[model samples]
Target: MFKPLKGLLVLDFSQFLSGPSAALRLADMGARVIKVERPDGGDLCRRLYISNLELDGDSTLFHSINRNKESVSTNLKDPADLQFVRKLIEKADVMIQNFRPGVMEKIGLSYVTVKEWNPLLVYGTITGYGQNGPWKNKPGQDLLVQSLSGLAWLNGDADQPPVPFGLAVADMMAGGHLVQGILACLVRRGITGQGGLVEVSLLESTLDFQFEVLTTHLNDGGKAPQRSSVNSAHAYLGAPYGIYETKDGFISLAMGSVTELGELLACGPLAAYADPASWFAERDEIKAHLRDHLKQGNTAHWLGILEPAGYWCSDVLTWQRLLEHEAFKELQMTQHVKRDNGAELITTRCPIRIDGEIYQSAIGSPKIGEHNDKIKQEFGGVVRE
Candidate 1:
C-alpha cells in the first residue's frame, strides 16, 4: 500500500528492545529486514520475559518487536560466518546494531569498516551513553537510564520517592530517535549518493524527552522543578492540571482559568486564585480544594458539567474500558499475526498511515535462523570452509 521502503534491505544485528524496535519500524514501512543473530540462543530478548509470558518458546516482548522480519543466525567470531555476513553487509541498504561502543569494532563490523563495502549504506547505532562519556560502558537498561536522566524525579506526588514510568520509555524513545535519524540520512543519501552514520544513546534520548521542563530549569535561574504536593502529573505545571478522584472513578483536567474552573465546579474557594500567579504559588491548596470537590460527584457527572463548557478534561480510563469503547474500535489499531507453525499472536499494527492507508502484516517473528536456507538461495552466498 504505497510503502516508501519497498525495495530497501536492512540487516538488524541488534538484540533486545532499542535496536530491534528501530528495525521493526523500518519493516513496517516495507523494508526487508533480516535479523542477524547468533546461532545459539539468538537474541537475549528471546528469554526476557514480562509477567512470565511466552509464545513459541520466545518472550512475548521479543515476538511483539520482531514481527514482519526474517532471521539469519551467524557467529561473527567464526571466519566462515563472518565472511558470509560481510557479503550480506555488502548488499544491505541499511544496517543497525546496539552493541556497546567497541563490540562492533572488535567484531570487524564497525561503520568505519563496513562503509568501505557498501558506500551508500546507512549505519545506525544505539548506545547506553555517547561513545566518549564515562557512562558509555554502563548497561543501557530502561530503568537505569530513566533514573539517571532525572525523569523519575518528575513523576508521582512530591512527597513520594522518585517514580519511573511503568513502560520502557527510554528504550522506546531511543529507538524512535534512531529511526528518525536513519530516515533523514536516507533522504540525504539520495541527494549526496553517500551513506552516513546515525547514533543515539538512551541517556541522550531520555534527556531530549525532558527538553521542555529542562529548558525551563536552564533558563529560570537554575531552580529545581517543584512538583505539586497533591496529584502531581507534571512537575512544572500549575493547579487544575492533574487527575482527581470522583465518587465512582477518576478524571483529569488540563490548563484553564482557575476562576472559570472554580465557577463551573462551584468551588467558591478557587475565586481567591483569580490571579494566574496564585495557580502555581498555591497549587497545593487549589488542587486540594479540587480534590475534595471532585470526589463528591461521579466521574461522568463532573465530565457532563465541564465538557459542555469547553474545558479540557476527560474521564480516566483503564485498558478494559478503553478497548470496549467505540473510539478505540474505530482506530483499528490491533491485528492478528501468525507464525509458520500456526502460533498466532494478537498485537498492534503500525501506527503510521501512508496516503490514508494503515499498514498491517500477517507474518509473525521467525525462529532463530528460520530463513537461512531461503537467504542462501536468494543471495547465493556460500560459507568458506
Candidate 2:
C-alpha cells in the first residue's frame, strides 16, 4: 500500500488512550512511531485492563493501541536520559503528549521549550480541560470528562441518572481531533517550512462531538434536550428514531415519515400522526405505539417490510452475530498481529482504506525499551554511564 507518512518520525509521549491513539493512526498511515516511557514501568496503560484478559504480561488494551510502534524507556528525571530524549526530540517530526497542564512544563518538555529544540516539530497536546482553567488539574479520565462535558446527559432514559457512554468516547474524540490538528500543522509545515502547536482537550472534543444537538439547544431558546420516554435513541430526533424490541430480537429505526412507517408496518396507531411537528410533540406516544407494534413481529419480519422501501432501518445485532455474518467478513476488518516471541493477538485493523488498499501490519507492540539499543545506534544518542 502507498503510505503517505512513511518517512515521518512520530514520538509518542502520551500514555493510555488519547495521545497514543493519535500516534496509532499516524503509524497506521506509515509513520514510524516510538513510544517514550518511564523506565520503571513504562506506560501506565500496560496495566490498565478493560477485562481480566492480558497478553505477554500486559493488558490487551496496551497491545491494541500500541501496535506498529517502538518503545524507548527513559526516566525523564535522570539528566542523562532526559538529554538523550532531547536528542531524539530534536530529530522527531511530531510529538504527542497528554500529561496534565504543568507536568510537561516542570519536566522541561513543554511545547514552548521543545519547539526551540526542533523548530519544525509539530507539538500536539491533550489535556482534561485545557491549559489554564479551574479544571486544568482535574483527572483527564474518559468517564470524568464525559460527565463534566455534559455528554452523560445525552445518553440513557430521561428518568434515569446521567449515563456515560460504555466506551471511552471522550478520549477517542480528543485523539481524533489531535490527529486532525497534527495533520493540518504538518500540511502547513510542508508549505511554509514551519511547525506549530496543536492542542485538544477531552472536554472540548466531547463538546464538539455534540455540536449538532448543542447547536439546536443554542438556537431553540436554550431548552434542555427532551429524551423520548420510550425507545429513545437520539435526544433531539423524533419518533421511530430508536431501537424497538421485536418478537425474536430488536430493530433500529431512523428518521422517516410516521404515517409511511405505520402503513408499512401495518401499525394502525401510527396513522394518527401525519403532521411532522407531531413527530416531536407526540414522539413519546408515537414511540410507545411503535415499541408495542414492533414487539408483535420478529426482527426479520419487520426488516423484510422496511428495508425494501429504503427506509433507514436495521436489525440490531450482537458482536457474535455481526462478526459471523457474511457482510462483516467481506470487510476483512480484523487482522492477526504477533509479538517477537510468537504470541499473537486477533484485533481489528485500522478502519482506513487509501486508494482501495487496506493497511495491516504483522508487528505487535514492543516491550518497554525494546528498541533502545537499535534507536541509540540509529539516532547516535549517548546516555551518561
Candidate 3:
C-alpha cells in the first residue's frame, strides 16, 4: 500500500495513552515511530493493567496502544543518554511528549531548544489542563479529566450520579487534537521552513468534544443539561433517543420525529404528543412510553420495522454479536500481529483506507529497547550500542 508518511520519523517521548496515541496515528499512516523509554522499566503502561489480561509479558493495554512501533531505551536524566536522545530528536520530523508542564523544559528538549537544532521538526505536547493553570501540574488521567471537564455529567439517567464513559475517551480525544495540531504544524513547516510547538490539554480537548451540548448549555441560559429520566441516551435529544428494551435484546434510536416513530410503532399514546417542541420538553414522559411500547417486540422485529421506514435505529449489539455479524466480518477489521519473539496477538488494525485499500501493518509492538541497535546504527547517534 502507498504510505503517505513512509519517510517521516517520529520520536515519541510520551508514555501511557495521550501522547503515545498521537504517535500511534503517525505510525499507522506509515511514519517510523521510535518510542523513547527509560532503561529501567520503559513506559509505565507496561504494568498498568486495566484487567487481569496479560500479553507478551506486558499488559494488553500496552501492546494495543504501542503496536507497529519501535522502542529505544534511554535515561533522560543521564547526560550521555540525554545527548543520545537529542541525536534522535535532531533527526526526527515530529516529537510528541505528554509529561507535566516544565518536565521537558527541565531536560534540554523543550521546543525552543530543539528548534535551534532542527528548524523543521514539529513539537507536540499534551498536558492535563494547560501551561499556567492551577490544574497544569495535576495528573492527566482520563477519568479525572473527564470529571473536571463536566463530561461525566452527560451520561446515564437524570437521577444517577455523574457517570464517565466506559472507555478512555478523554485521552483518545486529546490524542486526536494533538494529531490535528501536529499535522497543521507539518503543513505550515512545508511552506515556512520552520518548526512550531503544538500543545493540547485533556481539559480543552474534552471541552471541544462536547462543544455541541456545551454551546447549547451556554447559549440557552446557564441551565445544566437534563438527561431523560427514562432510558436516557443523549442529554440534549428528546424521546425515542435512547436504548429500548426488546423481548430478547435492546435497540437504540437516534434523533427522529416522535409522531413518525409513534405512527410506525402503532403506539397511540406517543402519537398524541405531536408537537415538535414537546420532544425536548416532554422527553421523559415520551421515553417512558417508548420504553413500555418497545418491550413488546424483539430487537430484530423492531429493526425490521424501523430500518425499512428509514427511522434511524439499530439493534444494540454486544461485542460477541458484533464480531459474529456479517457486516463486521466484511470490514475485515481484525489482524493477526506477530512479534519477533514468536509472540502473537489478534487486534484491530488502523481504520484508515488509502486508494481503496485498507493499510494495515503486521508488525507488532517491540519489546523494550528491541530496536535500539537497528535505530542507533541507522540514525548514527551516540556510541551507545
TM-score of each: 0.99, 0.98, 0.97
Give the alpha-carbon lDDT of every model: 0.94, 0.92, 0.89
* lDDT digits (tens) for residues 63-133 of candidate 2: 99999999888889888889899999999999999998999999999999999999999999999999987
Worst 10 residues of 1 by lDDT: 376-385
Q: Where does the lowest 10-residue lDDT sum fall in candidate 3?
A: 376-385
- Candidate 3's C-alpha runs over 4 A off are 381-385
The root-mean-square deviation over C-alpha atoms between each candidate and the true structure, in angstroms, is 1.2, 1.2, 1.3
How do the residues 1-385 of candidate 3 rate in per-residue lDDT, one tens digit apiece? 6698889999999999989889998999989999988878889999899999988899888888899999998878888888888788889899999999899889888888998889889999999999986777888899999899999988899899999999999999999999999999998998999889999999999999999999999998899888888888888887778888989999999999999999998888987788999998999889888889888988888899989999999888899999999999999999988788878889888888888888788888888888888887887665333
- lDDT value for model 2: 0.92
lDDT of 1 at 356: 93
lDDT of 3 at 221: 86
Residue 180 lDDT in model 1?
99
TM-score of candidate 2 versus the correct structure, residues matched by position: 0.98
Order of the predicted models by lDDT, top scorer first? 1, 2, 3
Error of 2 at 167 (Å): 0.4
Candidate 3 at residue 350, lDDT?
85
Q: Estimate the overall C-alpha local distance difference test score of candidate 3.
A: 0.89
